[model samples]
Target: MKRTTLSERALVLAPHGRDAPIAASMLAESGIDAQVCTGLPHLIEELDAGAAFVVVTEEAIASADLHPLSDWLEDQEEWSDLPFVLLTSRGGGLERNPAARRHLEVLGNVTFLERPFHPTTLISLARSALRGRCRQYEARARLIALRDSENRFRTLFDTMDEGFCVIEFLDGPHGPASDYVHVQANAAYERHAGIPNVVGQRLRDMVPDEADAWVEMYRRVLMTGEPIRFEQELVATRRHLELAAFRVEPAERREVAVIFQDVTARKRAESELRELNETLERRVQDAVAEREAALAQLHEAQKLETLGQLTGGVAHDINNLLTPITGALDLLSRRHADSDPRSARLFEGALQSAERAKILVSRLLGFARRQALETRAIDVSSTLEGMRDLIASSTGSGIELRLVPSPGLPAAQADPNQLELAVLNLCVNARDAMDGGGVLTIAAEQAVVGPGDAGALRPGAYVRISVVDTGAGMDEATLAKAVEPFFSTKGIGKGTGLGLSMVHGLAAQLGGAFMLSSALGDGTRADLYLPVAQAAADPAPVGGNDAIRPVKPLTLLLVDDEDLVRAGTAEMLRDLGHVVHEASGGAQALAKLGPDHKFDAVVTDYMMPQMNGVELAGRIAARDPGLPLLVVTGYAGGNLDVGLPQLAKPFRQADIAAAIERLVHGEKVVRLRPRRDANSAA
Candidate 1:
């Protein structure tokens, strides 16, 4: 009782006799489902309802209206071509009967089966028709599946975020892959590329200027069937894009799929960030350089201050020791002037050597910027002339000396003795530089300084005395520290390293400046600038005091902490025909004073224990304001403001006598001393 489907049943139309019944029986016996149509009207109705095939006799529709049956065949779906098995009388086949052709025209897909033939022939023709109808149904199912897949693909392709397109490479006039056509493109394509309606449009027509690059990129993907990813700029639209391209399957199809997105903003931000980093890098370098310069300056100041303190302390002790030696030697030489010739000569030689030691100590104090300077107006030309022979002897024969003093040059303010020593030191250094042989030129010229010039020099007229030498010179690193105390490049025991430092200190003390310039393998030049003198140079003094003796021998109180120094000074004072009271300290010297023992003057050492010379002077002044006081010191600089007559130590008997005589006579002893601040020059 199951219902039959169109593809599983057959319709029989043979209403003329037992033809319809006989055909239905044959189909039923063959195990095929069949429907018996009563007439042509029933056949049309059964055809509309659907059947796999039809079995009809020729007599039934040969002379009847075949329009409805023909119309049904014409109205069938494209995939439907209903099969028919036609039963014909003798000579009723299409080839034998002319009427059979009309029936064939009505049944589009029909097979002719002649009547009076075996029933096997009818059954075989019905089976063949049903097989053809089954194939048509399978084709219809495939078409429906293909249509549904296309719907889903189109929906996804249109909704994706990234721009997508299918391009078909074309062979153009130029060559293969010379052009490509955009066969398929999605909605995002226009938004990303700024081109609209690109389907079926050639790349050359859309962006002619950039077409070649685009085609070449995609052509490789198509030819090699490989995928590529890259970033590129679309010159036509001025947009930067990140794109990925892959060849479509089946290489011969010559198609590539491209996915891309706009990346212009990101690229611009990266460019800006790169520039900002470069700027910051330069700023950081500049800041570091500035900080290094400041640190170097601070280090130099601290180093100089520390060195000055150390040098001053050492010079003080040495000067104290030298004072006793020099005083004893002077007394011995004078006493032995009429003794054995050999003994007298030995004493004189020792005295001369001690004087040299005193000069060396003075030079050390100068490098420390604590030495007292005797600055005065002096003719540089005359001074150099006087030292010509002496400088020549110091430089030796290998070096040629040249002195070029500018004519009409004004006098410069400086210590003449120190200036001569500075020039001699420079010449000796020049001689050392030239191991083979070279010329050493000393020149003097007038210079005027203005504000904002180098070397921090005060604006004034000055005399520039330069020492130039042709010799192996110093490089920048060495030149920068040439004037620093004890920073020497010479081998040990060859140089003291204080020559240039002494020169620099001397210049500064005299209100001048010193500068040096040199280059490796070129040569060196040292320039000393001294301020112009306010007055003309003083004329040479005639012979006066070769030996200073006090006006008359008087009672003297001599106080010093060093036993040897106090004993030697007491001996000198007694030999000068003065009654002397020797004390080891300020307190001892104060105790010696009483009404029975009167003293004409008190000579005290500035640096001592128990009480210093200044404090002792104050106490003595309270008791006897009219008594003369002389303060002698080994330490020459730094905040020693004693309002009494002062004499630097390491002096001969004549120097001490001169100081005491000046004090006793109330004569002012002018001394050029350094300021209270140790950092400032004298």
Candidate 2:
């Protein structure tokens, strides 16, 4: 419950007579609430509680102790000047009566009324006191509101992050506007300006050297009543400050308020950056020629990168076209093995040509860095000896060919097919370098590479196969770019300029390096280093009908976008005694797999429209995770991370049967398990 406030009412003190009652009744008639007190002490108590004004007779306090009442009048608030109407006997006015003068001293704002006065006169005086009391109440309310607003502003001003101060222009021994005094400042002033107790200090005293500039800047704001913002350095403190100054309202006062933040760190950083840029500009001007050469090399590299991407794409399409043709020829060769001699020879030639085409496609993919290498340990000496006939035929009979292999050489780890291609490219390059009859030496030996080797090879055992030719060699500049794609020295139409680059790529892929050393008129030597294998060499598989066939026939789903590729694969599966179901693409394959249909395994081409093989495998796995999946693709760079087996394109009937057999028997098959990404998983 809220306590009642009686500040608006009047207090009456007429203890000995009807004066108090009569005065209270009169004020009540005029719409005023009055409280009647028995004595001066009671009236003082009522005043403490609250009252707008008081009405008291002169005799009530003439002989009594008036100290309490006097103290109350002195203790009133700044906004309060309580009015008092004294009811005195006749001739009781302050000028005529000595006792009335005492009351006047005690009650500062008092009016004296004689007892012989009319009732109208008493009522009129009482109302006049109440009117003055009302004005005091209004003043008290305004003072309270002003104090609350000041409190809020004080809180905000002191808590703000920026330094704030009010400065008043002063006319000192100097001239007008020559100095200023800080009238008020917040806590942050010391933090930002590095000055303490500045509220009463003059600008000239605090910063004697810098005061003039600050005074001039603020003086303009005062005169024009405009705000100014600027960043300036305080030389004495070695600090930079961003400040805004505005003239205070009622410009006659000639005062300005300043708000500032320290920006020393930002200013220093900008200065350092400017100096560094100037140094860079000088260095760039000095190295213009060298930079141009490097830029030319970069542009050539970028072109080769683009061509590699195009080559990979074209290789994918070519592999798809070759798949059916290779499969058909292999099946036909087997069916007509005992045919007439001429027909058999013709078939053998056509199959050899197709095998050559496949090798060419593989080399293209290798140059594009998209071919998945099937690396294994192999005897380096045996491999070199096997390629001896081919190398001799390519170099022509005019050139002398020699093979030098160290006895009991360790095996090296590499992809056999890619390894052959790389060596062939190196030998052919050596033959081209020899314009006349020259000797070509092919040497292989086991060597240990140390940490400080020139090839940047890791410290390990390796087989270094060097192809040294005694022929007209290249100069240093030409040799430096010998391994760069499209940098051939041969006539434009005679070379594709990718042989050395392909060799370099293959070496790097197999964890090795290719280095060329040559000088003008001297011979060129190409070294191909390969890592030594830790395990024994993997024995080459012997082809046989029983080894390639599955134990039992399986129901298989064959999916491919290309009609010929799909049909050829389906026919191969049927020839292996498996019931085959075919579909043009992933969506059609999904539509064909209904609740009534069941298959032991799924084989889908990787790159297709609408949906790819990985996605189809995922949908099928969601329905039945136990179902085995086989992804057949011509594109070797696809992300096939669905935990399925993969078979490369241009596979024969035996390769398909072997893949299906492994899938059915739950055996791990060799595959390209590319890295999984967000899109492939989804």
Candidate 3:
């Protein structure tokens, strides 16, 4: 093998240019590659560039500023211990010089030699220092490999398909390992168990019902040193659980690892399959019965699918028609300026009717799964209390209205306004059902539901609000279709049949459940189950009338296909002190904006012939990246994801002004009252 070189590459810090070359020659003879640095800055640069060792003269370290050298040494990692050699005079002046002594203390691994020292001695010292440095490099390489291995393991643990946890057996006051503490767990453990923040918690404290049995099973595993696998019911979540537990061998403490999954759905499916087989045998004896059963199921499925498609299409078209009408009303309101009382009242009545129509459309669309909800934490007791007067009026003198609220009930996580609407709808239905005048009770209470208890709802704490009525109850068949849209027993023109359907949609969309129970002669009880909020409800702020800010004159490019909408919007912009330029389409707008021509901002409509707003934005970005763009849309299906500012149709003058102000002044303005992205998943 070839001879190994000492300090394979070296950096010399010698302010004297002539002394640097001499040092390089001495190191080169020993097959070491060496470079000379002229000053402290140059020396630091060379050290940062990865030198094996640093060599300097006593005069350089003593006379020159050594603060930089001190800082460089302070920044090194524990694994890094760079070797250095100092050439000093024959006198032992370094011990007496405080500055030199301080520099020596800062540069930890430094060796010194007199001027008359032998070349072999210097070379020998370098060889020893290089050997120690080689070990450090080896240790660093091992540390990096260990970190990579740990990251890989953690990724696999977090993405497991089943729950996994490590439990350490704990001793009770008079029992042998009667409980266990969860020491470590993966992300999937929380998801599969439907429990969060489980680490460091004892099993007995978390679920007292199953504590004894679960502890006994693990205790057996530890005693026999054998693994056990079984399927059993989890009492806490009421779920059928399949798990395997084994003692961790050679561990210092008594520990075991458990792996499990909730198999409730599988169990239910198996039970249904068995029941269907029994029914098939009976139907085989009567062939006509089997065919009729299959035919009825298919017909019901197809009818619902067809109705949903038609309703969704009609709702979209109606919303489009309402957009322009609402926008026109806004402009008219501004023109009237609340100066005439008669005109103002007429305007207010029309606006209220229009708003009611919008809510009706929203309910229809919501039942069709084409609407979004704005969810928040709301106090159930307070919401019911506020509606006491309205509920009493809705029942009239015929029925007695009662409100009963449970004490210390937690707030529910839902949209406050939507929850109010759901409660109101339930009350109306109850009142109509009790045609002969009876008692109507509305009550709210806290409840805990488990995995397989509440249908289609996960295990958690909930706020259950019930509305009971002493009414003429419906039969089983009618009760089954109570939540179906457009399914009603009321006479023609009596109701639209969307009350219960809308309530059901509201609960589902807000991540809750709705249930209705009734009998032919008895009363009816409707329960709305909403998840309990973890935090207190936020207080609603009261505000006075908003004062509009005056806008400075700005040159703007406005693009839209509709002449009426474009004209109305341009008039509004002009009123705000802006000089507006109109373009009927995106192509026309681009032509107006040539290479040399520019404007303050571009405002364009999303749906247009030839080129849409998003495409226009892309072209503008390519030409002038700094120019700001805003897109307006009347169509409901626009999917512009360029992160440009957007305003929905039917926007008031203040809405558009706020959107523009956000773009120009870096002020945060709330976008047109709570809109979910059209492309977002329901």
Best by TM-score: 2
TM-score of every prediction relative to native: 0.53, 0.54, 0.49
Q: Write the per-residue lDDT of candidate 2 for residues 596-651, one digit (tens) a residue.
A: 78998889998776577887877776577678888887767333454668888888
Candidates 2 and 3 compared by TM-score, better number: 2
Q: Mark the 10 consecutive residues where model 2 has the least summed lDDT.
A: 670-679
Ranking by lDDT: 1, 2, 3
- The positional error of residue 523 in candidate 2, measured at the CA in angstroms, is 1.3
Query: Number of clashing pairs, model 1?
Result: 0
lDDT of each: 0.77, 0.77, 0.72
Q: Write the per-residue lDDT of candidate 1 for residues 86-178, one digit (tens) a residue.
A: 778754444578886677667866666665754645776677667667766665554455446456556766886668788998999879779
Instruction: Arrange candidates by TM-score, descending.
Output: 2, 1, 3
Off by over 4 Å in 1: 1-283, 286-302, 338-349, 404-410, 445-462, 474-498, 513-520, 532-536, 539-545, 637-639, 668-682
> Per-residue lDDT of 1-682 in model 3, one digit per residue for the tens?
1212223588888776467788788888988778988888998877777777878877787766778888887877645667787777742345554455655686766766556554544665565556556655654454455556456556755776667788999889639789999998988776667878899999888998888888889899888878777787877767777777777754457988777777776655554544543443333334434444544544444345345434533443444455556656666666684686777677666665655566666655555655456567788998899899988887788889889999999988987767878899999999989988999999999988876783887789999999999998889989999998778788855776778988988888777899999997788999999999889976653321134588777888999877767887888788788889999987799898986556888888876655767777777666777778888865342223446687765555677888787766774322322223432221
What C-alpha lDDT, on a 0 to 100 scale, does residue 549 get in candidate 1?
51
Worst 10 residues of 1 by lDDT: 673-682
List, in order, the clash count of every candidate structure. 0, 0, 0
